[model samples]
Target chain A: MTDDREKRRLDNTIMEGLRSMPEVDPPKGFSARVMENLEPKRPSAWTRFRLWLTEPRSVTFTPVRMIPVFAAAMVLLVLGFYAMDTNDSGNGMRMSTIRFVLNDSGMNARTVAVIGSFNSWQAHDAAMRFDDATGAWVLEAQLPPGDHEYMFLVDGQKLMADPLAQMTRDDGFGNRNSIVFVNGTYEQAL
Target chain B: MALLAFFLLSASCAWAGDAGFVKMADRARECGVSSGMIGQIESFTAEGSLSDAEAVSLLLPLVAACADNFPLASFEDKLAEGFAKQVGPFSIVRALDRKLDEFRFARDMLQDSGGGVAQQALVVLGEGLSKGVPRQDFKTYVSMYGDHAPELFLTGLEMMSLLSQAGFDFRLTRSMLDVGFAGKGLSPEWRYFVRIVLVARQRGLTDDAIAEAAGTVLEDSGSLADVAVHLGFTSRDLSGRGLSN
Candidate 1:
């Protein structure tokens, strides 16, 4: 019994010794060191010019040198087409359908409603209906868009944003909205 | 263009050899042996005798072929030469055989005493057989049994060549020391003579040249201990060397 007890104590001591070894950590300012090493060095003007002049057989023409000529020709062509196609009638704004798709996969409820800057943040004015067959909640409203932010409310409890929609700035209360850009271009998410 | 051709040829040859090695590995695995064991057997067949160059060549490929099987970092040629000089080829085999015997005896004794010792002995024997013996010999031993003992014995000799190259002191223990005389009823003087033979073999000294070197070391140095010490060996092992003819 005494011998067994002594052996147990020795085993515990060895285990403790092994456990006491310190964990290894990466060196300090590791990210900054990596960034500093990876930063591109600027080449001399002569070296840059030599690199630009050497053309591979695959791309025989230099696109960088011809950009200005291409842009001037495109502007002249577009102006000529516009001069031939214009008609003088004020048919500008119309009440067209602006589709709202609740693309949040986390929304578990049967219905979702949009409340944001466009709808004066009103929940009752624009309630979205769930299409059970398509497995999606959608809303269609008439609105002229420059930029907007919106939030999705599901089952009167959970709040989320549409993952497939456009970007928006953060509201002070930790919520965000989907934005729409009208000129066929949207600002990318930051 | 020549360089490119050479590179292409070498690459193709390497690919073919890799495919061959894989086939050998599969056959070995099917036969319940490790690839290292298969390689060791192949090495022995390639070089019939345990000459220094033969040993060096065998060890190089065995290590390269089965790096995963052994705990060795790398075999050094100079070290092997040093060991070959210290312990003759015969003595090296005798030493390893002695170790295996002792391990077997220990295992038997443990079984007689209690089941625990037997279990421990078996574990030790298994580990020693796997790690200490060359993989090819071990595999051949397992697959072929009695018929393969001669080849396994030669494989053991090959191992001595490797150990000599690696600079291991085969006379480090009683079991290791008695290997050369375990079955051979060699007298003390004859054992000493065998030591000289081993040293000569290590120096690539032929049998006819032994008398001349033996006389010079004994006469010029008064004691074999002094000579062995001069040769970078511990003085205790000099007792294996025989005195004047």
Candidate 2:
């Protein structure tokens, strides 16, 4: 009980000393300095750009001064067109894809292939797949741009002509070979 | 001295075969024959499709063609075609001989018609000659139209062959080419004369009818596409079924 009384006396003495202190005014512009410190730092580049854009500026107009700019534009346009043309020519050098189709609806052929100058006339090099929907044998080949002579070999024994060939030529071997002109059209004669 | 002479003679003979082979290789390079062509022939021998003697016979004419500066591709292509067709070795040799003759005839014609002919042009003209275009007709066409651009010349020759094969009269064929080469009526796209003729034939237009329509429209500086339209040919007739077909 005596220790509790001593603690209460010390607390009262400190409280009385704090209550006896007098009120005083702060230094001049102290609150203003604090407010200034609280304000944001330097503006960003985007803000400066927006401020510059909103500000007015004068622009001059003269045809003679634009001549160099116009010439540069023309040069750029020409280079662009030249690049486009070069790309087109590169594509032109590529081999054209030609589809060879043989309509063997009634023959019920077990095998069919395309023999032509493009493949050195190999019998089985360009075998055609039988499409059930169309009932035909079909093959596609990449051939250079030129005239190629071809024929359909049916079932490894019979040499058949393309029934819908655009042009047929004498194979000089007593058989007619289909001639397909593979040009820009990518069209197969048959 | 006697021993030295024998060694020198032996060395000369030893190098002779290799020198001949090197010379032949040089000629093949000049004539556009790939060295692999020999490899193909040797492969044939290995495959037993050609005897040693028969292979030599096939190679002799190719070398002769090279020595004469003839285009070897036709011979090469024919040889490959014959082998691919499984025609015997002798048959391939005979075909090569025949092709050599065809190329000779073509070279002679090109020479007779004012020589300065390119190898590709010679090949195209040879194809025309072989397809049965008359020598006189080819000479006239080449003399008249061959001096222009190489592609145009080649196209003209190809058209001559195809049209003649299709039974178009020489004079009418000549006239169409004249209009195409005139450069006033037809577009510069006349470089594709072969394609135009192909589409024309595919449309089933008669030779006389095409000639008539071309004579009327093209002579008056009309467009190439117009000649087909003048003959009542539609875009559908000109168009193909393409890959879907």
Best by TM-score: 2
Candidate 1 wrongly placed segments (more than 4 Å): A1-93, A103-106, A183-190, B1-245
Error of 2 at B16 (Å): 18
Each model's fraction of native contacts: 0.00, 0.20
In terms of TM-score, how similar is model 1 to the real structure? 0.21
Please give the distance, in angstroms, between residue B54's alpha carbon in candidate 2 and its true position after superposition.
2.0
Tens digits of per-residue lDDT for model 1 on B1-245? 33543443344345534454445445434544444444543554466644333233223332332332322211222122213223343333333233334345434543443333433224333333423434343333223322222333332333332232223333321132233223332212221233434454455655445434334444442333443444545444332211110
lDDT tens string, model 2, B1-245?
Answer: 33543443344345434554445445545666776777776677688876555565556567768877877777777777666566665555555665666778778877776757579778876666655567777778877875677666776677677767656689888787787677545443333344455567666866777787876776777654666578776534444333224
Q: How many Å off is the CA of B212 in candidate 2?
A: 1.8
lDDT winner: 2
